[model samples]
Target: MKKLELTAQAEDLMKSHSLQGFPNEICGFFYGKTVEGVKHVTVIKPVVNAKEGDQRRRFAIDPLDYMKAEQFVIAEGLEFLGIYHTHPLHPAIPSEHDLKQALPSFSYIILSVQPEKVVDITSWTLNDDRAFEQEEIISNRNVNTSANKAS
Candidate 1:
């Protein structure tokens, strides 16, 4: 199975973001480097949930936000590892909409968020057959000293 190394700081920030956006889904980008087949998340860039109407059930990152995130990742010399989003009041399992929107070569980190806290977190990746497969999340306390960029 593929692995993702999440720093403690990143996890904390994700939790905070989820709570702040509780009742609505939040979206963001994960920036890091992939070494030895493991993706190490060093930075998380939160973006506005640009979806129209029912934000409680969906999230859409604006094209401009994507472009800016890409620019930031390039400037920081990091890979655009994947996307992170909250599933308000739901489990971390991907929905059919999520599966349809997933892309190959990118990880999807889903946070199950309640009104007051995050209930769960899970990482997923797309397989060759275009199906979602769970990835192992290895929590690393030591943040990446070399990559200090965060937003």
Candidate 2:
């Protein structure tokens, strides 16, 4: 099984973002690198949810935001691993709209937020058949610290 590794800080940031967004969905980009075949999230850049209305059930990343995030990733010397979004009151599963918008070779992290808390977090990737497959999440506080020390 492929693994998506996240530093404790990254997880905390996502949780905080989700909670802050509350009844509205929040979206962002995940910046990281793949080490030994494991995708390690080093940074998460939260962006405004550009969906015009009824944001409680959906979220969108503005094209300008996407471009800026890409540039930021390059400037920081990190890869644009994928996207992360909150599912206000929904489960941490991709929706039909997500399926249609997903791009191959990118990881998608979904967080289920209820009221003022995040209930779950899950990572996913599209397979050959264009179906979503869950990726294993490995949250470790030491991973990023050790990697930075090696640098």
Candidate 3:
């Protein structure tokens, strides 16, 4: 399976956001450009954030911000590479509900906050059967480095 390279800051942000979204799901996207030699897989996110949602954690992007994000990515030469979400009281694995809603081309990242003490994050690549195939995350903490560039 392919591995994902995430920045340490990105990982911590994801954990904190997941913990904060404690009873519901929290979602967002990743943005970055490809580092040479990484090819299509090199695209990564320097930043990640939670989208607005109700108390239940059901969220949809702010229409204006969504459009702006698309525009920003295009203008900045970044890719809308993956989608991330937190499972407040669940495991760091995709649920049946998640599989049903997942889009094939995008990577599905799940952050589980069941422990209440810390958040556990995992990535999955879905197949035709809607099963989540486990993947890896390589966390980068250095700035001004090409470690997690998106393609």
All candidates' TM-scores?
Answer: 0.94, 0.92, 0.72
Candidate 1: C-alpha lDDT:
0.90
lDDT of each: 0.90, 0.86, 0.62
lDDT of 2 by residue, 1-151 (tens): 7899999988888898889889888888888899998998987788888899899988888898898878877897888899999888889999999999999989999999998789999999999999999999998888552122100
As a whole number from 0 to 100, the lDDT of residue 18 in candidate 3 is 64
| Candidate 2 clash pair list | none
Error of 2 at 105 (Å): 0.8
Q: Summarize candidate 1's per-residue lDDT along 29-56 as a digit string, tens digits.
A: 8889999999999888778899999999
Give the lowest summed-lDDT range of ten residues in model 3: 37-46
Number of clashing residue pairs, candidate 2: 0
Candidate 1, residue 7: the lDDT equals 91
lDDT of 2: 0.86
Clash-forming residue pairs, model 3: 32-150, 33-150, 33-151, 34-150, 34-151, 43-150, 43-151, 44-150
